[model samples]
Target chain A: MTTAAITVEGLRKRYGDVQAVDGVSLTVERGEFYGILGPNGAGKTTTLEITEGLRRPDEGTVRLLGESPFPRNPELLRRMGVQLQASAFFERLTAREQIRTFASLYGVPAERADAMLETVGLTEKAGTRENKLSGGQAQRLSIACALVHDPELVFLDEPTTGLDPQARRNLWDLLRAINDEGRTVVLTTHYMDEAETLCDRVAVMDHGRVLRVGAPSELVGELGAASLEDVFLQLTGREYRQ
Target chain B: MSAEAFTSLSKAMALGLLRDRTAAFFMLVFPLMFLVLFGALFKNDATARAEIVQVGRVEVFDSLPRDAREGLEEVLEIRRSDDRDEALEEVRAGDVDAVVWQEGDEVRLRYSAADRVRAGNARALVDSVVQQANIAATGQPPAYGLTTRQVEDESLKAIQFLTPGLLGWAVAMGAVFGSAFTLVNWRKKRILRRLWLAPVSAGTVIAARVGVSVALALVQTAVFLGVASVPYYGLELSGDWWLAVPLVVCGTLAFMSIGLVVGAWAKTEEAANGAAQVVILPMAFLSGAFFPLDMAPAWIQTVSGVFPLTYLNEAMQDVLSRGQSWGAALPVMGGLLLFAAVLTAVAARLFRWDDA
Candidate 1:
């Protein structure tokens, strides 16, 4: 049997007095578009960071493609793509140069890097420095950089948090196309509509723990709720903030 | 993969630094400005001649032998002033450095103390001439003659020493500020976390930064030496000057490690900048990068010994000015290597991929 693309069990992480990710557990099947839906300060970013191997868990086990990620397994890293909440690029580097540098890190060819830029619809802005790009353009460039190596699994942490509605829809279409390429995609976002529209399944999270995990419509129907927002309100007995 | 990452990262970092106009100004132009300013100020190689007014037909001047009189004339521009009161007025008015007259067997010299160095020089020269005349009158050869020779090449001027000191300051500022600012900014922007997520090793990332800093340091050294070597500055390069290459590398590593520590410890760009300044400014002064430490108090000189920049400046000056051999710089390089190692370990211990 093929293993799950990612399996995280009993994940616990604490920062100072705060339990950022307390006893979280989840799994994503290969080629599935998954989302961790939460509000700000709800531990989505921390969980994503731990899962991406950018942070170590306090106590847990995480397996990506049947291999542990921490202690930095390069083989696993080569297979995974992670775009953090804040997009970062080399100082003063143009869009093409930024993606090319990332590609070079993974030994990917420059042609592929340029092609990835085109894939993000940034071909005309290839010569534009990263700082000069608009919010939407920057986010797309960041996503392109993350996917330049064509990893088997991708993680995006709040990719559309500050984008306008139109840019958000554009990014959603791009994310859907990425998932359509048979790559498993894990995303964290606060927008209920975003999860309902893009996720095959989403894990509803709050206060550092997963409340429930199911298909967005199934969760709505299971609780006899009008939407994922109502499902969150029903599950937590509180109004959804975002 | 690491090799490729290193190359790409180094290239990116180099380009970033070159493109940053502010950083380029600080790293390259600022210190070179100090070099040129100080070079121009100290460019005069000739010893200054003191202007003296002979208050009368001074008997001592006429009694001096012909060759002795000519030699004194070269050091002292003597003008005859028959009016004693006029000569004294000229000395007080700063028109002349001193006024000399013979009163009986005693030669009285009157000079204004406002220009102490010139007054002191004139006093010493006049005293020596009088002593020589006294000895000649007794018809006795001088008991002991003193000869002086400079340890360094006679052509070496103040600029020769100033060049290396300023060069050391320039290199230190470049490496330290470059690394500290880069690290802090990258961490704040989450680039460190991004790079960590990639397959590249941390060593590759740090090595790339070090490689870029060292390369820039070499370029700074070349520019400093090239500019100082011009005829206007008259900085003479001599004996194992090439040894400064290794010294520059070691010094850059040491300073960049300090920057790494600052970067790792600071959570904000402002904090990092403040911390870097706190480390660099005092080091530049105390390390004798701006002036000679020997002229400082004994305790200050002792305090300067603890700084890695002090040794860097000293060794660079030795190779560049005193024409010292490799033996002179080897121990200093070893010290710098130790500093680099220890500070690097501290930086690693303090390093965090993200501010969180």
Candidate 2:
């Protein structure tokens, strides 16, 4: 059988008084575009971090490409790309230099790093320092760095949260192209439209639990709701925010 | 693959440090400024007067001519002591430059070798006093003469000693501040988490950071030495001066470990900076980076022994100024290594990848 890109089961995590991710489970098949949709404080980022092996789960098993992600399996790490919610770069480095540095970490060629920058439409801004880049431009550079090594699976957290409508649409196109290249793409966001537009399936999370899981349209149809927001409202017996 | 990661990370960090104007200034120009300022201030000043203590009544000194006695007193601050043992202890402890006494016709002068220049001066002044007394007694060359002995070597100057002490402080400040600020800023900006996502281990990242710090420390040493060695400053390097390279490396590691502890414990850039300053500033003063510890109180000298910078400064001075051999620096290097090992353990225990 072909292994799923990611498989997480019975995930549980707690931070002091808050249960950040309680009994969460999900799977993403190879080459699938997946989303974990939630509002603020929904534990989407925490769950993603655990799955990416950046954090250890209080209780759970996460297998990426048929290997455990925790304990830092280098084989899995080599095949996965992750972009954190916060954009980070080496200080005083220009865009080209930044991506090239990341590429070198994975033993990728500088030419490939430059190509990835171009693919993200940041070629013209390659010479600009990271601090000087616009929000959209910086985000694009971050994604370019993540994909420079061509990992088989990619994880992005809140990639479009602060962009303008124009920048957001442009990023959506770039993400779609990445998925179309047959890489398994997993993302977390609060935007209902973004989930409906990009993900083949999405897990709706609220207050540290997965409330429901399906394609956006399938979820809406199952509940006989007008939209994914209404579906969330009906599932939680409350109005959906964000 | 791991090696590649380490090399790339080190290069990137080095570039980042060089490009940050403030960091570059602290690492190079700040120390050089201290060297130039202090060198200029002491350039033309007369040598300090020697302080001597008389163990007992020396009949020869008592019989010196009135003019000769007054002249010798001008160059020597001599105090009389009844207990010969206590006077000898003071000389050994550097409380006094020399201790003088008389046995029959023999005038004896004993001086501490710790401050060779002062000891040499004290011996010369006391010998002149004895010669004048002999002439007054017989009006011809006397049968007995002044006997002088040195506790150690006699080849040091104030500037020669000052160079190593100041250089040690400069290297220490650069390593501590550089590592602490880099680690805290990286965590605040989420760069630590980003590196965590990569395939390399955290050890590799830290090793790369340490590599860059040591490289910068060596650069600081070269700059300080180059500036001080200028003919105008007249810094004379000893044969074993190259031993300072290993000593500098060990000292840098020890100080960098302190920075790591501060960085790992602080959650904000301000906290890290404050914590580093709290640790480094006092060490600079207590380690005798600005003044000789021999002149400090005994209690302060004992307290200074606890700081690794003390060992480093002492060893650097021994090799760079006092012309001591490698044997003098071995024990200090071992102490610094032990210090580095202990602090590294503490830092590892406190390390965090992110604020969360």
Best by TM-score: 1
Instruction: Estimate the TM-score of every prediction.
Output: 0.93, 0.84
Residues A69-159 of candidate 1 have per-residue lDDT tens digits of: 9788988999999887889898899999999999999999999999999988999999999999999999999999999999999999889
lDDT of 1: 0.91
Q: How many backbone clashes does candidate 2 have?
A: 0
Pairs clashing in candidate 1?
Answer: none
True contacts kept of each: 0.90, 0.77
* TM-scores of chain A across candidates: 0.96, 0.96
Looking at candidate 1 chain B, the ten consecutive residues that score lowest on lDDT are: B40-49
Give the CAPRI rating of model 2.
medium
